[model samples]
Target: MKLIKGTLVALTCAAMLMGCESKKKETSSIDVKDAEVSKNLVLDLSVDKVKNTLGTLKEADSFPRNITKGQKDWNLVGVRDWCSGFWPGVLWYAYELSDDPEIKAGAEKFTAPLKEIAYTPADNHDVGFMVYCSYGNGYRLTGNEEYKTVMLAAADTLATLYNPKVGTILSWPVMVDKIGYNTIIDNMMNLELLFWAAKNGGDKSLYDIADSHAQKSMEHLVRPDYSIYHVALFDEKTGEFTKGITHQGYADESMWARGQGWGIYGFALSYRETGKEEYLDTSIKLADHFIERLPEDGVPYWDFDDPKIPNAPKDASAASLVACGMLELADQVKDNALKVKYTQAAKDLMAKLESKAYFSGDTNQALLLHSTGHLPHNSEIDVPIIYADYYFMEALVRLKKLEDKIAMQ
Candidate 1:
């Protein structure tokens, strides 16, 4: 895969994690103007790609999930599907970057259907994913009062699943009988909704709920080596720790790439909202492990211990999530060396993602390709998944903000 010469050199330095101060200085000398031009070009292309994908949809209520093998269009899902919010989130990001009227209208059209999810009592913890990602971003960008109302109600609905005994949100209520009170690493991502609601006239206790969940996740989900388990089980009656297991990963002992991504992003976000040093430390540790284990290309395999090694399917979704997470982590870090390390790592991952190897480029309606979702279920493997595109676009937006900040400096 081709990468910019400067980016390639910086990535090589980052990968070695040794004495490369001179190399880092040299790569840092690249012109800010050139970086801005490249970033804007990618953002424009992403906006166009989102618009094109909207054209392919026959129903306004349908959401793009993934494009399966041999399929030219997206596999559509209903509003209740776990992935339903990502497409609208993608459109919101596209509009944020481009400010195009057509993209804004599309974002509104798609985000409207998700309002039902806010009021509906959900048995699962994905209400945050289903509502916050769509309406949260919409409310942020547009300040629509209706969007705010829907998000508050969704936050309330999500609060119902938080088990006080477990000190965490129950991720899958249906699985509680079979596996006890199960909380996946992915649930950490949903805490942002609760955090937001507590600040936005919903309920003050929502913040405590989110904080408790993050604290509990840090206590149980993170391993000693900083690698994260996909699922952490707790006894329903006493809230005692049961065990850590895997649902979508290669094995119970393996570090699932996306699960690690969730931990990195979730803790970084928790640190951002609460200014907890332990959360920042956890994010850094998880990020360090993730970066150290990455393949030569900077993107990661679906699972670190999948045993397929050189032949494993790549998960661009995980890379996208980590890129955004590392960028956020960089913003919050006071250590110059660690900040520079994370910033460079994020750039390296984004460079790899923008390459011809991963960018969809008219091959499909999505922005990215080769994301593995539920590989054990034989589902959505090596496909262009919607969340990958959403986070990829969000990472670009974050990168652009960083560049603008540097240019001003």
Candidate 2:
């Protein structure tokens, strides 16, 4: 049996006292449906935005972190940065959408720097973001054998962090205090790399590790209501659960917005790769918990259970991640009612992201806005982030394909 930590008293106290209660107004609204016209409009607008933004970005051997100002200047980060892969990912989506030679070449060039990360050892749990988004998309588009090799190396490195006794991979080996064995919800996203490795004839142990890690996450990181904790701490020697807490969330008991997004996206991908009904069911439950707490607009505050709910900053990246996961979940469900419900939720979220409030104007080169990154540290507050734009574009591209299939039906 699992330890099942987290004091219910703390949860009850946080729920009763946390989350702001305010009815905010939206700047505008658009009805997004599964239609050719609506799909084309969004797709065309996205392609143009991406092309223009890429033009502003300097053509160097690196990736853009975020737009510093109006299209005139941009910030660039090295391959070691956690966000290095998203720039190429957005470019790859552009190539997929338009099939333009310029965009294709740009994607390939930007992805080149990331190949080094595959072989380099990283103790953090974001290797999937670093390698998969860049090399993974590159391989998917071009069938490049080199990209496959890099992915295999990355998967092997990621698997090294797994502790069989703990039943999960270590998320942050070096925390402030570093007293306990820890796993995080974000680690779930990395399992896809392991799943991909096993499927591609790399190693069966990769699949077993991923499966066990996800099962451990479901049992410990997830609360009874399906809201997730940011971290699950374990006793290193006996693998006994010690505590559950949040490193970046507003409070230890609060549900971090981005963590839930990782849970939703990671579990959905797991279900797709393994055909596991339990994973799918867990994803749906998490999605419902997420959707039910959202404000009038589909976007969410940085921390769902934060004390300052209505006044809290919105994390558009989390919204994008969850919206993408919802679309995937909609596709996998056999029940028509569930399929329609989730599909509509996804569309509404996408439409909301494109609204005047969330979408950037000509002033900013970044596509999406109002993302709160590490609010507790007072860093990158209410600014556009690269991953937000990457996942937003991904959701839009996926929505277009879904519309095309609907039209064919």
Candidate 3:
């Protein structure tokens, strides 16, 4: 049965543990409903919504057809690390819910190779979330040495990008003698790699470097409103923030949908790493702004402020990322009212996405509908995105705590 193979796949990375040299803490207390009945009601509603969404994904055959792609069009599972990484996370959540060894195997099968991918010569900053969030979690769940090795190696590679002078990792690759390039908002996700290194690899310097880079981004990349500027120009040798430009958005200052999502979760992560109230405060401010500006359905338009992208559809991937971040923020924040708002907003948004946007016919392709890859870059607009699917499943599992995932359509 496909279910058997699916479960077996997760075994590849099962029984791994997170290696951390330090403990990260946030002092904020979440305002989870104190009344047992009220909390249960909210939890039940969220769980029901999550189950229905997972069901839709299963019915749709949501796993991408081609895991490794040649690039005629887009394949959700383009490569092992690029898109397929989500499978491990999905499997982990599935295993959590069902206690099925098959689900566990699936997560392992997909997560086992993360080290190789991250160490590849072409690796970039997103490697943290791209590799670690999937495989690292697998290692954490299963105590698997291979996945842990990979996670550590990936963290090391990510650290190599650090520019001590500039106090941030050089984001993308550039040609020899080229200059005028810097980090992107998406790179924020990479900090987790450094964090893992500090925790598990006995590398405190890595965390220090990560902290410095994050501070640089906050100083130059994040706007006053907490909206992000995608790409910035930096002095190559000096590594100082030169200027911020809108590389992925309409212009230099426009906030991209995905970029905003990246910032919310990324900054929240920074807060998690260090209990500094400022990061938490910044995260809340951005989350509030994002929630307030969301479209009626809770999914945001491509840009919260820009009007240039023509007929921009709601990005399912952005919504999914934002939801996960919101949930994380909800659990992290101390204020009762704020926690309720963030958690409820996340749930409400996912509920709508689960109901209206998910493709329900094939288990291999279950994803919330209407994702835009990139407009200017023309990557994938209004379609399925693997990261979106990953974060969506992450949100579901985080919310509902369901675990048994069989790859049955």
Candidate 4:
């Protein structure tokens, strides 16, 4: 009995020591290291370029056009940024990288008008992307309840704005006798906001709607070629696919760069959430086409084969968006070769944009310049855009990962 008691005491002491050692181990929040970041290529786009751009322009209630010294064609469509769901998102990404007070201040300029967006009786599914990426992400990083209040209000607005009977979130409000556009591939990108709302709002049904639309997107929006259709019509009652088309693509027939980027990124996220092979497969297939179409410089034309239209300079912004998507794609694929190829493709595109269109010897906007947004409609025809800035920074993060892998090798 004495011997047994001694052994038990010894074991207890050893176990306590082991537990202490385990607890003593240092905890790292994130393993990502920038040491692998390519030495000659770093500009700290978050800090330097954004500081320069913001220096040139003030946060107007509206977007500034023809407003900056470098701006082309002095026309203030100012709505393009809003169309991408306005300020918070772009600034959210901005602050995440820089932790800049200026970016936070900049985010507020759009909030008042954007609050109206959440409350507006129209079905612009992008409010989540527009507002949450900024306000929600901001609150998450900082733990400020004010941002949460803004998001809650936004969710209420989105809930009111939601068309429940349609079984999908309508993107744009009805414009005079227009069929409410209940389904668009772009909404796939917007669903993240709904998922977030469900999380924060305690509304499980909100996520159900978001999930249903995503399933529909996979079912009806993707073609056999794995090229995604831009729009699909659904029966409001049944959620059945009634019809689908390519509204934003060239001639309703070709792939649009930004839309494709949305598809790849959205599908990749879906896979990340569900770990489903189909989503992963779909992401890989679309990614394959995106990679195959890259110009020698790794930047893509707005449309992959845009008929070589005369006087059409390239859309470097589109290239940047695709590059950002490819970087995410690199993370999803399990195959080593696919991972290296996608990551390298993204890095090569970044190198090209940085060297060619994105960089200026003295200018601080080192990510990209002269991007053409919606040339056919003549919107933001040729200007640097915020999404381009966001994507460019995201690519750099991925590039940093690639660099780390290279260092490890």
Q: How do all models score by TM-score?
A: 0.90, 0.88, 0.77, 0.76
- Worst ten-residue run, lDDT, model 2? 26-35
Task: Give the Å shift of residue 283 in candidate 3.
Answer: 0.8
lDDT of 1 at 26: 30
Cα displacement (angstroms), candidate 2, residue 24, comes to 26
What digit string (tens of lDDT, one per residue) describes model 1 on residues 2-33?
22444445534443443343444332111222
| CA lDDT, every model vs. true structure | 0.87, 0.80, 0.65, 0.61
- lDDT for position 325 in model 2: 85
lDDT of 3 by residue, 1-409 (tens): 2233333233222212111321342110011111121323222333233334333333122334221222322243434345555655665665654555655665665566455666775456667765776777787777888777777777777788788878888787662145465778888878877887798864789889888877888778888877778876688777667778765576777767888888888888889987777778877877887877777656776776657434566677888899988888887898889888888888877766665245322222444456776667866666666677668767867776422222232
Residues 155-212, candidate 2: write the lDDT tens digits: 9988888999988998887762565789999899889999999999689999999999
Poorest stretch of ten by lDDT in candidate 1:
25-34
- lDDT, candidate 4, 1-409, per-residue tens: 1122343344345445555667763211010012222233233434444555555555454543321336332233342344444334555555555566776676555544555555554455667766665666567667777667767666666655455665566666652145434567777766666667677854777767676666767888787777777777766566566666665567555777777778887887777655778878888888888777766656666666478743445666666777877787788899999988888877777766676345432342434565667667766555666566556666665576567678999
Ranking by TM-score: 1, 2, 3, 4
1 or 2, greater by TM-score: 1
**Candidate with better lDDT, 3 vs 4:** 3
> Which residue runs of candidate 1 sit more than 4 Å off their true CA positions?
1-39
RMSD of each: 8.2, 11.7, 12.3, 14.3
lDDT ranking of the models = 1, 2, 3, 4
Which regions of candidate 2 fall more than 4 Å away from where they truly are? Answer: 1-39, 68-72, 176-179
Where model 4 places Cα greater than 4 Å from the true spot, the runs are 1-42, 64-81, 84-88, 99-113, 159-166, 179-182, 235-240, 309-311, 360-367, 401-409
